[model samples]
Every structure is written in structure tokens, then in C-alpha cells.
Target: MRVIAGTAKGRALKAVPGTNTRPTTDKVKEAIFSMIGPYFDGGLALDLFAGTGGLGIEALSRGIDRAIFIDMDRISVDIVKHNVTAANVAERAEIYRNEAGRALKALEKRGSAFSLIFLDPPYRMKEMDALMLDLAERGLVEDGAKVVVEHDADHVYPETAGAFEQLKYARYGDTAVTIYRYNPVRSEHPMEE
Candidate 1:
């Protein structure tokens, strides 16, 4: 796959050497950016369950100041490193090989807050609800921060996950993309899906 836009636009990214990791398709990636942002000014980003660091790297290329990428697989981590280096954005990225829960806890301990958080865990995991709540409780997300979740098309998420409210949702083939924005104050009417 390749970066669809920004500074690293058009750069080809290498996939992790096995079927263990599913790379986001360029079409869906382009769609996601179109829906959330065609570009960004600057902000810190977190890519949990990062696979080859494509989403985080794309965010960096699109003007995110810095990004922390986390993945549990060694091969995926290596692939991410390679992709980051190839993009010449190593200085703006932190790549780590760790499980999602542990990484979230560490980020929480650091008292980190992200402007953008990408969640693309394995389809079978079904941990999005719990993870989103944990992120909210830990204050890991900035107020008005954007959280993007990618999952199997059949998987349905809540209209609101903790303080984050669903802003948009779309399906592309077998994949579904859900975008949420952190808003502690609730409105009289929740947004319709």
C-alpha cells in the first residue's frame, strides 16, 4: 500500500510479512481522510494497534506534529520502522512493540493526551468498547479529540463511548470506519448514526 496524501504522499509502504496483519486499503484510507480531514494544522497522535504504522505515518505526513505507534507483533513493528525510515519521518515518530492494553496503561501513566487516536485492532478481539472507556477514564484523549476505529463491517459500535460521541460512520466493502469526537458535555439529543 501507499500513503495517499501530504508530505509523504505517494510513498509506498511495505506490509508486515504475514497474513497476521491486515493493511488498510488505499481506497478506504482516502475515504477516511476525506471524511475526517483532508489535512491538519498540527497535533499529537496515537496509533494503537498500529500495523506497519500506515495510519500514524499518514497523520504525520498530513501535519500531525508527532505520533506514537504501538503494536504487539515484532514483524509489524519492524515493518513500521522500515516504513517510517523510508518516509524520512523517523524523527517525528515513536515506534514500540507492545500489547494494546499495556501500551495504553503506559501512555496513561505518562499523562498523555492525544488529538487523534486510531484504533484498528484485530477483528476477533472485540475490545473497542472497553478500550475506548479506558482511554476516556485515563484522560488519554483531549476534549474534542478525534478517535477513529476500524473494524469488520458487521461489528456495530455504540453511539457514544464514554465521553466520545460518534461523529460519523461508514462502511467500505468488508470494513467499517467509525469516527468519534470527545465531548464531556452531553447535548439534549444524541447524534443519529
Candidate 2:
């Protein structure tokens, strides 16, 4: 795959070795970016289930000041680092080989907050809602932050997850993309999809 746009536009990216990790296709990646931002004015991002670090790298390329990529698989971690180096964005990124739950806790301990979060866990895993809730409880999501979740199209998601409100949903063949915005001030009602 390749960087879809921005400073690293057209830079090649390597997928994590083996079939355990599925990289987001360039089309879906472009669509996700278009939904929240075609660009950014500098902010932090977290790729919670980072496979090849594509989402986080894309965010950094598109203007995010910093990005943290987390994955439990060792091979994926190495691939992510290699991709970051190839894109010349290593200085703006932090990559770790850790599972989602533990990574969230660590981030919380560090008092970290992200303006953007990407969740693209394996299709069989269905913890997006719980994960979002954890982020909310830990205060790890900045107000107005966007959380983009990529899942199988068959997966069902609620209108709201904790402090986040569903802002948009789209299906790309077998994959679905749900975008939620953290809005703690609004009424406790979900926006209609």
C-alpha cells in the first residue's frame, strides 16, 4: 500500500507479515480521512489496534503532530516501525507491542489524550464499545476527538458509546466504518444513523 495523501503522499507502506493482521485498504483509508479530515492543524492520534501503523502514519502525514501505534504482535510492531521509517515519520511516532486493554491503561497512566483514535481490531473481536467506554472513564479522549472504528459490515454498533456520539457510518463492501465524536456536553441522546 501507499500513503494516500499529504507530506508522505505516495510513499510506499509495508503490511505486517503473515495473515494474522489485515491492513486497511487505501480506498477505505482515504474515505476515513475524508470523513473526519482531509487534513489537520496538528494534534495527537492513537492507533489502538494498529496493524501496520498505517492509520497513525497517515494521520501524521496529514498533519497530526504526534501519533502512538499499539499492537500486541511482534511482527506487526516491527513492520510498523519499518513503515514509519520508510515514510520518514519516525520522529513523530511512538510504536509499542502491547494489547489494546493494557495499552489503554498505560496511556491513562501517562495522562495522555488523543485528538484522534483509530480502532481496527480483528473482525472476530467486538470490544469497540467497551474500549470506547474505557477511554471515556480514563479521560484519555480529548473533547471533540474523533474515533474511527473499522469493522466487518455485519457488526452492529450503538448510536453512542460513553461520551462519544456517532457522527457518520459508511460501508465499503465487507468493511464498515463508524466515526464518533466525543461531545461530553450534549444531552444524553444519540443522533439517529
Query: TM-scores of all models?
Result: 0.95, 0.96
lDDT (10s digit) by residue, model 1, range 1-193: 9988999999999998778899998998998888878788898999999998999999999999999999999989999999999887899999999998889889999988999999999889776978988988888988888999999999999998778889999999889999999887663344733
Could you tell me which 10 consecutive residues in candidate 2 have the lowest summed lDDT? 184-193
Error of 1 at 46 (Å): 0.6
Clashing pairs in 2: none
Which candidate's lDDT is highest? Answer: 2
Q: Please give the lDDT score for candidate 1.
A: 0.89
**Residue 47, model 2: Cα distance from true site in angstroms:** 0.4
Identify the runs in model 2 with alpha carbons over 4 angstroms from their true place.
187-193
RMSD of each: 2.6, 2.4
lDDT of 2 by residue, 1-193 (tens): 9999999999999987778888999999999999999899999999988999999999999999999999999989999999999999999999999988889889999999999999999999987988898998998999999999999999979998777889999999999999999988764544643
Per-residue lDDT of 51 in model 2 = 92
Top TM-score: which candidate number? 2
